[model samples]
Target chain A: MATEIVLISLLKILVVVLTILTCVVFLVYIERRVSAFVQNRVGPNRTGPYGLLQTVADVVKLLMKEDIVPRNAYKAIHDLAPIISIGVALSTFAVIPIGDTIELFGRQIKLIIADVNVGILYILAITSLGVYGITLAGWSSNNKYSLLGGLRSSAQLISYELSMGLSIVGVLMVSGTLQLDKIVQHQTTYLFGWLPAWNMFLQPIGFITFVTAAFAETNRLPFDLPEAEPELVGGYHTEYTGLKFGLFFLAEYANMITASAVITTLFLGGWHLPYVEYVGLSSFILSLVYVGTFCVKVAAVMMFFIIIRWTLPRFRYDQLMNLGWKLMLPITIINVLLTGIVLLILH
Target chain B: MGSNGKIIRKKDLNFWQRMYIPEIAKGLRLTITQMFKPKVTYQYPDEKFVPPPSFRGRPVLVEEQGVERCVACGLCSRVCPALAIEVQASETELEKERYPIKFEINMVRCIFCGFCEEVCPEEAIVMSNEYELVFTSQEEAIFGKEKLLTPIEKLRPRLEWLKNNR
Candidate 1:
């Protein structure tokens, strides 16, 4: 069992890291494509056959590009910030179950790095650490724009984090377990033996709040006041260059992938296909199918992220805060209370 | 409000409108339809997009055994619509007339018109539809002789055709 656990853990880490990289590369491609389609333009069509190799070429270029550190900047922290951000981003994936375990080479392997009893909490805490990089990078740069962006991101993250945590608290309460795999298992059975087991139906309010919070956390559009280019210029990494700049971008997409994974795990019933029983399919085939199903769900959420980004205008920083604290928070709290009462009576 | 001076508005709620259920069902129905419908995207690697008949793409330089067919003629440079093409000439190993020694196209400047093809008597520089030109920097977009030549020109029969004809 220990050997199996060790192998599973290794596999999880490998999958998470690779997926993070692959998803970031494709997410950029997809975002460009979606944005192009929206604006009625043909996006990236060159690189490796249909421009699929564009990201790979970009990575090579970035790696080969000159590394320039500003003379006035705090060299140590400026260098360390991106590392911290990427570290935090990668760490959050440890708690997420992409899909359930299946027989592999005659051994069962779980799809999570660590199925900690407090997995949800662990993910939340780890993700929160990502802000440190932005703050440190901003402070180190000594640029006014970077400093202002860093401060805005900090305040924005802090405000939204509260409501985001609260929304998930209801989910944790309902599931009664922190282990993501177990939460998913609990959600596998239908609510009325007909309705599919997913939190989207049960906790609509929480789902909305959580999705909104994710948009805020990712520093994406509408909530993207931090990098409001017209106002704040290039945001926290305005002065960053070469691999350092690449790392910031890397962390952003990694966090995005993590957010999508978290959404899948929490609200979308990670890897659980509606109206389809996993009991009948062969274990190996079932795992593959589940992984495919999980990817489709993540892709939909990613597309939704892109679509909303294109559709919505950037919210004023104040408006963003008001929506988070005044509107979303109040509605979510009432939802939690009402949901709690209903669950209690049902129980 | 109905009896008092203040006016009260009556709201109508249909079964579907009363809840978000109808909207969600509609969304699901649309997604289902799209899933079954032919994917609009051209899967470029395995299944390339079938270019339209007049699709503008790769630059074709006619060759006799991998050597360019221009015979040092400067007509293409004169006829280039955007004035973006540059060709330098030098005597080939054949010890006959000079051919292009350095050939390049400034893709950033080139309007992608088939002007060069129309101007060429040698049937050189026809634009094929195999365009996948993605680059992060401006420098990468500039094409040299190596990149300007299509992969088809390197194939055995075409190379053979050029050599035998020459």
Candidate 2:
């Protein structure tokens, strides 16, 4: 029984990791194509059917490049930074429930890799650690531009992390739990017998603040001051080449996927297809449908991320700080208070 | 509006604009609509861009009825800012009397300035529409009379353009 449990856990980890890696590869391709479309120009379509294998080609090319280390650089720390970045970005997926518990091999299994009671806390903690990677990379590279980028990123994360956490506090108050699966399960219930009790509806201000903060956390455009090419010249990864640079690139998209999945699991209904339970589908088919629904929700959120990146210009440094501290922070605090009051009254 | 000229401050934006969400929505709508619109990419290699007669390309000597129009005046060589043209005058049995025995233009030195064409009194040398110039070696870049002579029919558009423009 113990062996079986170990094997199941291993299988789940393997599946989750592989899925996240593949998603990162495709996300890069989709981002390029979508950005091209937004600008009224055709993107790379020549590299294997609408540039589907473009990211794959890019990875192979990155692998072949020479690993250059500056003479004045802290060699060990520089090497370790991308690994830290990639590890933190990928590990945040462990607590996100893609689908509900399902029967497999005559045994019940939860879809989440790690069923930690404090799932939301784990995600918040892991994502915050992502800044260390950029900061260390900047300091270790011994480059002025890289140092500035690293400093900006750390500041940005600090400013935004508060609002991000507070926004989630609003969701937590409504859901009454920290476990991601439980939060999703709470959202599965109907409000007023017709409206789905997704946190997006229950705490609209929290949803907006959370999404904005997620964009900042992911270091995407508008909040992508870390790698602002015009000023920073590839930012913290300025001195990075070959596979180390590739790892940082992969970590970014992986972070985007993690953010999207978390948003789906929290604010959106995780794997719940509204009114699907009444259709009377078989258990196995129902589970499959639920997984599909989860995937679709995540994809939609990711598409929103990509479109917003192209649509919005990067925030000036002062503007970013003002928005984060002055605007988002207060708004999220208010959202948390409002959510607590509503929950208290309803109960 | 006072001393600031036409500069619009953030405070000047009325409520909805200051909120930024509604303004962002408008921007998103514009971008999303642009996504479905026709792309403006020209697939090169598969699709070539043909230059018009007005375009100044590589200079060529006009060949008329199995003979060059050049009277070996050496004007184009003297006028060439790049000193690319080399004319060695020699007597010919043709009606022009004087012909270039060793007429050569070092493309390595040629700047495509069209000065040689502009100064040619006989209108013998003119800029053609052929711009694809590639050479592996310095020797290959030096065009002798054999390589420089282009038939009058092929030079018609350029010759006509020069006639009208001049």
DockQ of each: 0.04, 0.80
Write one digit per residue (lDDT tens) for candidate 1, span B19-62.
Answer: 54466456545544443444355545867775653666656665
What's each prediction's clash count? 5, 0
Model 2 C-alpha lDDT per residue in residues A1-347, reported as the tens digit of each score: 89988899899999999999999999999999999999998897888988899989999999999999989999999999999999999999999998988998888898989899999999999999999999999999999999999999999999999999999998888887999999999998999999999989988888888999999999998899999999999999999999999999999999999999999999998999999999999998899899999999999999999999878999999999999999999998887777778778978
Task: Kindly list the per-residue Cα lDDT of model 1 for residues A163-191, writing each as its tens digit.
Answer: 88989977877888778889898788897
TM-score of chain B of 1: 0.61
Provide the lowest-lDDT 10-residue window in model 2 chain A. A334-343
Across all candidates, what is each one's fraction of true contacts kept?
A: 0.00, 0.86
DockQ of 1: 0.04
Candidate that scores best on DockQ: 2
Give the per-residue Cα lDDT of candidate 2 at B126: 94
